[model samples]
Target: MRSGNIFLKRNEVVFVVILSALLLVVFPMALDSFRLNLVGKYLTYAFVALGLVLCWGNAGILSLGQGIFFGLGGYGMAMFLKLEASSPEHTAIQSTPGIPDFMDWNQITELPAFWLPFHSLTLTIVAILVVPAVFAWIIGVAMFKRRVGGVYFAIITQAIAAILTILIVGQQGYTGGINGITDLRTLKGWDIRTDFAKEVLYFVNVALLLGCLLLAQFVRRSKYGRILVAIRDKEDRVRFSGYDVSNFKIFIFCFASVLAAIGGAMFTLQVGFMSPSFVGIVPSIEMVIYCAVGGRLSLFGAVYGTLFVNYAKTIFSESFPELWLFAMGALFIGVVMAFPNGLAGLWQAYAQPWFDRIGQRGAPRPISPAPISPTAAPAERRT
Candidate 1:
């Protein structure tokens, strides 16, 4: 079927406009800098939810360990920032005046070879984009070629997350331990801690999110999207149709990983820190919950779901920190059981039909048949 446009339908284009207005215009106008910054942090997670929709929702590959990619990306960004923060002037008190404090604290005299590339901003950006893609490709090739998938794939991802988290925590000298890489103060000679900087970063984050949304839309409407749907519904049929199903799966998995990594990098920028705490099993599962609550099949729903869940988490945790976990559990259960399609499903079922009815009423009706209809019925009955 021909599309209304190359990427989005007319209505979808309108949605993009409306969403942009809401995020870029309305939000800044209505919120204080602090609150707006909080919302920006929430938007970072939307990247992961968006990725989840791409892979799990569209491609039908459930991964329970997205935090691995998120952490890696954040760490990539953090490494660069930490190097900047650890200038000799700032660390002159330590035995090694140029190394990160955590490294110095552990009595390490030199930076690790792996961290050398992050000293250059160009290489840091490249590493941020490339590392996650390569890692995901490795995982995808290893598993998909062997036909390992479904819940097994999910459990394996979880195991990987656990392993990565342990490694980060265990290598305290290099990784900063559980405390995480901190004291992040600036980027490229700009003070990120300033109010103006936070506001700017918030807008930058929102812009990236909107761009990613368009990217997701493009992918979903493309031929590749159709193939992903087919794979999800009938993988064996797709394979028999001469499509290399594993390659498609591997490509999408890499795509999703990169999205998560981008979010992680942005999270580091806006939040000013990165930690293994955000890289473990719990955070990974929470990312999955964000997608599930948003209606994984709906790209827009995935984003809205992230905002809703994170907002709820902030408010609920503020008052009842102890009970927040239980509340989260219940919320997930309720959304799964009652609104299986999530908020997007509700809109389609109730709101979309209402709009359709309104449109029909506004449209011109056909002229009624002449009065002969009644006379013909009587004549036919008498005959």
Candidate 2:
């Protein structure tokens, strides 16, 4: 196929434009500050779904511990904000005026060595990005290099998520315990709790999400993406073709982790807290469901899926409460049994064809082949 043809198709272009308009223009205009903030929160999950599309959809690597990376990035940012909010004057009543309130509550007198680095805004930003990537790299290298994959890999990832959640919840003073990191007041002297700050953060989140989408699109259209698919279908064949298949898997997994991390950081910024509630087995599986519901293969579909599922959750949980879990279970089962490729798959199978037909109708018809081709052919034969 021509290189130009490898990228976005007409339908895909349309999808991008429509989604962009909804997120950037329509959403801000239609929703109030509070609802718009909620939408922004949902968009953060879309980031996780986007990463899953690359890793699970294309590369066929199912990671059940994505929440670990998300938490790491979120906590990284939270640590900085927590520290800033714990300025000496802010904690003047405490014996140790410069430490976080939780630490002070636990009778801790000084900041931990690890928390010291987060005092710098630049370092905090770097840590938010790097910590998750590094953690992912280590896990990827260990599992992929050892040829561990499939269900086993998934189980191990789930276990890791469980462990991280336990660690965070167990260490009350250091990690804010079950409450997680709360009381975040400022971001480099700017009060983040204000509505205007949230609006700014929402735009920032949207911009970053779009940037991530473009990056994913580029990878999906490149030869490397084809190789990932090949490996997914025939791992041994790809390995025999002189490609270190494990390395590719590791790289893609790390890339996915980074994306999740970015989403986590944005979540912390917008939500005003980072909690262990988001970094555990249940949340990790839910993240996968978002990808699955969106059509794991479709990045744009993933965003819509995240939004749809989250919105439904809010509505159902508020009204039906007890039935929400059952409804969610049924929805998952329905998606798998009826539309394996998800909403995107349904669109491609039904809606896209209708759209194409409409476009064809609008196009100029070929001059009816100058009919009477039967007589014309006979004249040529006689000649």
Report the lDDT tens digits of candidate 1 across residue range 254-285: 98999999999999999999999999999999
lDDT (C-alpha, whole model) for all candidates: 0.92, 0.91
Per-candidate TM-score against the hidden true structure: 0.94, 0.94
Residues 1-383 of candidate 2: C-alpha lDDT, one tens digit per residue: 12353577666677778888888999999999899999999999988999999999999999999999889988998999999999888999998899998898998888999999999989988888888888898999999999999899999999999999999999998999999999999998999999999988999999999889978988888889999999999999999999999899998998899999999999999999999999999889889999989999999989989999999999989999999878888998999999999989998999989988999999997875334545577777555
Candidate 2 off by > 4 Å: 1-7, 366-383
Which residue pairs come into collision in candidate 2? Answer: none
Q: After superposition, how far is residue 74 of candidate 1 from its true place, in Å?
A: 0.6
Residue range with the least summed lDDT across 10 consecutive positions in model 2: 1-10
